[model samples]
Target: MDPDLPSSSLAVVLVRARNPLNVGAAARAMSNFGVKDLRVVGDYLQPLEAARSAIDAAPVLASAQAFSSVAEAIADCTLVYGTTALGDRDLHHPVDVLRDAPSHVRQNPGRTAILFGSEKTGLSNDELSHCHRLLTIPMARGGVSMNLGQAVAVCLYELHRDAPAQRNLPEPAAAATADDLDRFESLLRETLTAAEYDRRFPGNMGANETRELVRRLGLTSADTTVWMGMLRQVLWKLRQAGR
Candidate 1:
């Protein structure tokens, strides 16, 4: 949570948003929370101007870089989070940012970006795929959802609450991320195939089961690398033994 580094490490990305006012408002909100970099993805900034919202934080808007796709905007970032409303995306876990934000940022420091989609349709599943995790603010169920500015404010508020961050996390001596769990799933599936574990079912294990079981372990980045390393060794050892 090193304050200076924290501010620099995180950014907000708006993807194909059609509202100019919301764009301006979001940039203003981000600056208020000590975030200086805002990357907007669209053909250009016309919609942002139409919203008439970010005028006060004009500098942020002035320098905002526009990208054609989400990947280019977030590619350099090591940790990326997307905002989502869907519950059926089985490969990723649905985490409440309010309860999970602090720990997540503390653990994964570097160029990080949180994404918001267009006002009309929200983020696509493919756009979300680029993110390692998802963030959403809870609201009373109804036809209304928070406007883009409001959403930005709330997220920054939570992010800035324990202001001027100091990196305070356990630095997991052993663990893995959802991505690592994904790779593990592949490895396990291959092993199961080789061992004929699928003969009984003739298909394969459900992905939800894989995600849930690995997520239960809360593996750190380091933990995943180590675990994969060990897995390779164990497999090689078995091969040598058989020979």
Candidate 2:
């Protein structure tokens, strides 16, 4: 993983992933490739919590963002690719084999999102419509399908495999970041303390670890403000209960 490039402009978006184990596995893959951004499009929040609980999952999973829809999830991304195994369904968008897709992904200097559908159904036609293109991992047999977790790992590996040479391409626009992530960290710490999480799980995670967790979220300045507000509200409610 190249610390300098950091792949800050790249995000992995999971759509309606029903299995918590698969979510955790996908996050672990993102961690392996140094892709810090992970977005999930689903109404259920349990998978996110379960994934975060995985012992092997990195801070990437911990900071993963949730959205109610694919459009909302990929809103910040300038380019979007949907992954598919290729079946009887008609694919409207151009398809790129997994290995060759990385070049096009690197072509965009803005944020790029790769969407992975659920373990059972794969991406629906409506979902695929939002994608600029589709990516498929070549299989040994025409009909064999890859597991959701394994597919994520393979795509991430392909994206990261050629990073050194791809860096020569135009640099992506600077990603929006929180006020150095300090303000968000401070608010988060205060909220955690108010909720007595620190007392209950003493030394479970330290101040530095908390800071790193917030940093990994890769929130823009606007996102930080929203988080700050939410934390403050939580703190207010906690204090009210203590009264």
Candidate 3:
């Protein structure tokens, strides 16, 4: 099945990447696929060189939180996926990465951190145990290992391919916005004027614009009612406070 929330419940855990350019490139790849977070163990982004490498993904680098050890890096993640080329060890699945891709990511997630080891050894066995399972890139024999950044990019893209596109947050409920309220008040005034009501408008200004704003914002019924209450409060003030 396709992933539900997308934004990849995925995070890349790079242990001693050993190259600023690779880290930056990985950050860029993370940003590209909407991976949720990253955790790097060992010295990382020492001089912000990774941010420069991230290109337009500077925000990803800037916002990337850090950790000291592999266990610490993954402590908060509920499902942990590890990547490895040397599967000579005792792993349940010998050489398949995509077999149960979506379930492994979505089945368990307070967060899911996909671990990538150093540029040289991939993940050490100690790091491997921390993971719930493995995500292996299928390759023909004699294929050179994937570049670190490219490896992360491929894994994240595969995991999130079917998930929905997400923005930082849902547009704050339109009703909760001052901008929406202001437009609605303006519309109430204009609608009254257009019906030969508020004389101050004369030619009836701000009505069309206000209505358009409300419509464009996709205001809900609840939003209209809230605005109506606000207008009532304003009208009560117009009674001159029992003067």
Candidate 4:
């Protein structure tokens, strides 16, 4: 994929990054691959200011946004993925090796956020909870981790390597934004509650589980609208019967 192909839809998010040099390298990689949107979660002002001095990375760093939380950083995105090194930690999201992730990303046709964790510790479980899936770069040895800058470069190369030379057809409808999906989930929860499904199926009512289920549907903009309408109607009918 050429940088032009997915640049508009792809965003790079760094969580709790503490090193200015690594941050600079990550920005350079973004420039090399053509992705321009860079979002940093947590306190990043010092590092971000220093990173602006990196070679050819000034533009990317200049436009970067510092967000307080991952959710806020990715709010406008329709798909969210976190990078992980499969350690002993138990995981709730689907995992994809780096080689296979770009295809899935391309299929979504919406704004997508790819998150990188801090140097000392990868994303916490709480941080990972917001991601729809996890992506890992396969390594020959277990327990070995790449430098934050290298990881960013590798992932960008893979994502930008498979682009067609030219595009000739109309683009497909974009997927629903994360913000819109959040609303859909809320409405669906209300409908399920109105139908007493939550009481009957307590095991399935976990907030994270419900969120994953909605994301798995891969709903487009039109699909989200229709689904929301259907849920609203169901909720109204259930209330009417109760009255």
Candidate 5:
């Protein structure tokens, strides 16, 4: 374990995971890597008993928090990374190779959450919407999707590996929390709508572009506040002009 890395600052969030065994295995991996926080979104059967597979990680499983939605699960995390296989899906979030993500995560000063989806379908577009970035584990051509447990182990191992050397790196600025980013997005959307930007494009194209733009910005806490204030002022001006 890296003396400089606080296990509590990293959270492993399982979204709509159907198998309790896989969940337990993930917890076990977290224990191996010294990451202490575990969060589950959605329900699973007999979580407590199945978590016995966590071995010595039973305490980690025991302390896991449950939420009804992904947004709720990682609300406080400053950085949210969603894992995906990139199968026949349009990726709006910027993709980060799994091997490189750990070092980027290590530099961040705020809490980070790594989200993994269910075994069968993986993360849906709605769940992906809550993430700031996407990560994919590299494999051979035509390789089968990695098992949930194994994927968790590999990702956490990368994060834990060579932590001591990274300890000396300069700390990154405090990034915006998921909730803060959400608020900024909401305000930006409202401003766009107030300015009738949505009317120019058919369907949700405007809103979707707005979301992608926001995610790509990778705003810090201060950036979020500034954007929110600016958007709100624009919205007010739009309303005043309309009146």
Candidate 6:
């Protein structure tokens, strides 16, 4: 983890976790490692009692944010990583080993969100599509996946372990938030549609590719703002021309 980056800037996101105990345990782990942000996506059982298992992490549990979608939950984050068990499913994002993830994360600026999937089924393909990268915790061959809470704890521990000694660290750059990226993608998609770019592709292929491309660009805050303005102007002109 970047010594300059505060753990508070990191968020642990639980997606459709079914157990309140697991939620509490994850919160406890977050507290143990100094990460304070927790975001829950989709429906879960006994969400309110999650604090009981949080122990001294009650504050974290109490303040956990709930969202209807993974994209919405990470809207303000700049870097998003999705955890997986390395199942046989096809993946589009680059995979990062647990040990190497901390360094990659520390290299990025602004808020970072690490996502854990549901207890029964891990992150869906759609959910994974939103991630900039995939992370897999190495385990013995044929080993079963760790419990949701345990997995969260292990990942957080790795990020917190051997943390660099405090020093005058350079401040992180202002990266574009997920929401900013979404806006840019939306405008770009609209402009592309108005220009009949999608007609050249099948179904929503153009739109989906545009979304993925926007994320891959990893734009800074200023870059996003400038692009949004440029795209909006183009879209406006296109609309006028069509009139």
lDDT on C-alpha atoms for all candidate structures: 0.73, 0.83, 0.68, 0.88, 0.82, 0.83
- Report the Cα RMSD per candidate: 20.6, 21.3, 13.1, 22.3, 23.0, 23.3
Those runs of model 2 whose alpha carbons end farther than 4 Å from true positions after fitting are 1-6, 164-243
lDDT of 5 by residue, 1-243 (tens): 454664547999988777778888898898878888898888554553466545555578878888888989998998999998876688798999887887668777889999998888888899999999999988784224778989999988887776666347877889998889878988877887888877886465466776777888889998889878888889999999999
Model 5: weakest 10-residue lDDT segment is 44-53
Residues 1-243, candidate 3: write the lDDT tens digits. Answer: 234743445667888787777888888887777664767787555634554545565457776767778899888888777787644557753344654566656666577787888887777778777877777788774234679999988887777766655656676654445655665666567445444455665453455655555557666657677777766676556544545
lDDT (Cα) of model 5: 0.82
Off by over 4 Å in 5: 1-3, 6-8, 52-57, 164-243
lDDT of 4 at 63: 92
Q: Identify the runs in model 1 with alpha carbons over 4 angstroms from their true place.
A: 1-5, 49-57, 87-94, 142-144, 164-243
Backbone clash pairs for candidate 3 read 97-136
TM-score for all models, in order of appearance: 0.60, 0.64, 0.59, 0.64, 0.62, 0.62
Prediction 2 global C-alpha lDDT: 0.83
Give candidate 2's root-mean-square deviation (CA, Å): 21.3
Best by lDDT: 4
Candidate 4 vs. truth: CA RMSD? 22.3
After TM-score superposition, what is the CA distance of residue 42 in candidate 2 from its true location, in Å? 0.7
| Candidate 5 lDDT score at position 140 | 82
Off by over 4 Å in 6: 1-6, 48-57, 164-243
Model 3 alpha-carbon drift over 4 Å, by segment: 1-3, 6-8, 43-57, 92-96, 142-144, 164-243
lDDT of 2 by residue, 1-243 (tens): 454342657899999998989998888888878888999999888888887887776788878999999999998888899988887768788999988877787678788899999888888888998999989999986545789899999988888875676437875545446564777788788888988899998675597788778778877666677778888899899999999
The TM-score that candidate 5 achieves is 0.62
Q: How many Å off is the CA of 27 in candidate 3?
A: 0.9
lDDT of 1 at 132: 84
Write one digit per residue (lDDT tens) for candidate 6, span 26-114.
88888778888898897653563555445554678878888989999999989999999887878799999898888877877788899
